[model samples]
Target: MTPLAGIKVLDLTRVLAGPYCTALLADLGADVIKLEPPRGDDYRHIGPFQQGESALFTLNNRGKKSISLNLKSPEGLALAQEIAAGCDVVVENFRPGVAEKIGLGADVLRKAKPGLIYCSVSGFGQTGPFRDLPAYDLVVQAMSGLMAATGEAGGAPLKTGESVADLVGGLFGSWAIMAALVQKARTGQGATLDVAMYDALYSMLTTSHALHFYADKTPERVGNRHPLSTPFGCFETADGQVVIAVLTPAQFARLSTLIGQPGLPDETRFATDEARTENEPELRSLIEDWSKGLNTEAAMVALAEAQLPSAPIWGIAQASDSAHARARGLVQMLPHGVLGQAPVVPQPVQFDGVKLMTYSPAPGLGADAAEILQAFCSVDAARFEDLKKAGVVA
Candidate 1:
C-alpha cells in the first residue's frame, strides 16, 4: 500500500502552487479530488497543448479526479462545504478572504470537521501587509530580492528561467501538509498551513542572505561565481561551458596541478581561499585562460582526473535524456487515452524499494462529477440531476 492510501484531499487550487501540493499527496496514494469551475481550471488553456489538451496542466495534475462546481451559487457553496467536511485535506491558492467569503474557510470547515487540514497558499500569506495584493511568480521573485541576486553582474536583473517561487511554494505547502498530518495522527487535531510564494522564495536564499550578516553588505550578482569560495563557477571552454567547484585547499591544489599551474598553491594571490576570493577576477581569468584551449569534454575529463567536481552545462533535452536522470527514473511516459503518451515528472521519492507509477490521466473537465457525487455524498441520480439543473454541479 502507498503511504497515504486512506487520505482524501479536496483540491480547490488552480494554476501551479496549490495543485502541485495536492499532486504530491495524490502521488503518495491520497485520493485527490480536484474541484474546478464550469470552464475548468485556468491551466487547462495554458500552452503546450496536444489534441486540445494542455500538456503543462497534465504534467502537474495527473493521478487525480476532477469535478466541476460553481462556488458562486448557493448550492455550489453547500456542496463544497460537504466535500471539505469529508476530506482529510483542503488546499487552496485563492486570494486572502476569498474562501471565507465563499463560506469554506478554515474556521467554518474546522467547526464542521475539526480534523480537516486546510492549507492556504498565496503570494504573501494571509496576515502579511501585502496579503491581499495580487501576485505572480515574477512579482514575488522581484519583491523577495531573488531577481536582484540572480543573473550576470551589472546586467539587468532576471527572474529565474522557471517559476521557482511557485514551485517552491508548492513544495513547502506539501511539506507543511505532511507535517500537519503527522501531528493529526498524534493529537487527533488538524492544522492550518499558510504558505506564501514570497516567503518561500525568500527562505530559499540561505547563503545569499547570510552574507549580509557576515559582511554587513547585501549580496550583489556575481554571475556564476560563488560569493565566498574561489574557483567555484562556470568556465568557458572552446565549444561550450563547464561549471566546476573547488571547495577545500586540497581540491584547489589538485586543480592547480591539473591545470599545469603547479606553483599556484604557493602563490600569495592564490594560496588560500580568502586570497583567491579577494582576487577572484584574476583567479577566474587564470582558469578561463586554461579552459579556453580545451573543449567542454576535454575540460570535464581533466577536472575528473584531478577529482574536481565539474559538469557540462546541459539543456533540458540533454538533461532529461541523460544516463543519470534516466537511471533514476526522473522522467516517465504515461498513457493519456486521447493524448496517447504524455510525459510526466515523477515524484522524487522512493519507498520500500518501489516507486509508484502514474496511474491516472488528467481528468477531462467534470468527467468524474457524477461519480464523485454518488460516491462521496451518497447523492442519487435524481439529486445529482437536480443539482445540475440548479446550476451547482457542472
Candidate 2:
C-alpha cells in the first residue's frame, strides 16, 4: 500500500506555506481536501503563468482536491466543521486568532474529536509580542537574521533569491504534522502544532549560531566565500564561476596540486586551515591564476581527475533539466486541466515497495465539492445543490 494512503487531511489553507505542507502529504498519498475561499487561492491570481495558469499554484498545490466555501455563511462554516471532524488532520496558515474567530479553531474542532491533529503555520507563533503583527516572507527573512548574515561583507542586507522563510515554515509544519500522527498512533492523543516562520528560519542558522555562541562573534556576510575555510566557495574560471570545497587536508593537497600550488601547502602561511584562511586572498589569487586560464569544464575535469571536489555553478533551468534530475525522477509530469501534462516535483524520499505513484493535478476551484461533501459530510445530492444555491458551497 502507498504510504499515508488511508490518512485524510482537511487542508483549510491557501498561499505558499500551508499549501506546500499539504502538498507533501498529498504526494505521500493522503486524501488532502483543499478548502479554498469563494474566489479561490490568492496564488491562482498571482503569476508567472504557464499557458495562462499560475505556475506557483500548479507547483505547490499538486495532488489535492479543491473545494470553495464561504465561511461567513453559517451553513458553510458548519459544513467545514463537519469535514474537519472527519479528517485526521487540519492545517491552516491564517494569522493566529483568525481560525478561532471563524469558529473552526483547534479547540473547537478537537473538542468534537480529540484525536485530530491541528497545525497552525504563522509568522511569529501563536503567542508572544509579535504574534499580532502581520508577516510576509521577506519580512520574516529580514528579521530572522538571515538577511543580516547574507550578501557581500560590509554591504547591505539582502533576502535570499527564494522565499526560504515561508518554505522552511511549511517544511517544519509538515514535519510536525507527521510527528503528531505518530504520537496519535501511540497514545491516541492529538496535538496542536505551532510553527512560526521567524522561529523556523532563525533555527536554521547553525553556522551563525556556532559563531555567536562559541566564537563570541556576529556572522559577517563574506559573499560567495566560506568564513572559516579557504578555497571552499565560488571561484573564477575562464567560462564561468565554479564551486570548490577542500574540507580535509587530503582534499587540500589534491586541490593545491591541481592548481599548480603543490609547493604552497608547505609554506608557513598556508600550513594550517586557519593559516590558509588567513591568507585566503593570496591563495584565491593563486588558484584563479590557474583556473582563469581554463574553462569551467576543463577545470572541473582536471579537479575530478585529481580527486578534488568541485562543481560548475548552474541556474534553476540548468539544474532542473540536468540528467541526474531525470534519472532520479525529481521531476515528473502530472495531468493538468489546461496544460495537459505539467511538471511537478514530488516528495523526494520513497518507501520500500513503493513505485512512482501517479498523483492528480491541483483541482479547479470547487472542483471536488460534491465528492468531498458526500464522502466527509455524507451530504445527499439534494442537500449539495441546496448548499450551492445558498452560496454555502460553490
Mark the 10 consecutive residues where model 2 has the least summed lDDT: 350-359
Tens-digit lDDT track for model 1 on 222-328? 88888788989999999989999998999998988877788898999998998998899988888888999999999999999888999999899999999988888
Candidate 1 lDDT score relative to the true structure: 0.89
User: lDDT by residue for model 2 over 65-113, one digit each (tens)?
Assistant: 9999999999899999999988999999998999999998999999999
lDDT per prediction? 0.89, 0.90
What shift in Å separates residue 247 of candidate 1 from its native position after superposition?
Answer: 0.7
**Residue 178 Cα positional deviation in candidate 2, in Å, after optimal superposition:** 0.7
Provide the RMSD of all predictions against the true structure, rounded to 1 decimal. Answer: 1.2, 1.3
Q: For candidate 2, give the lDDT.
A: 0.90
Measured against the true structure, the TM-scores of the candidates, in listed sequence, are: 0.97, 0.97
TM-score of 1: 0.97
* Model 1 residue 48 CA deviation in Å: 1.8
lDDT of 2 at 269: 89
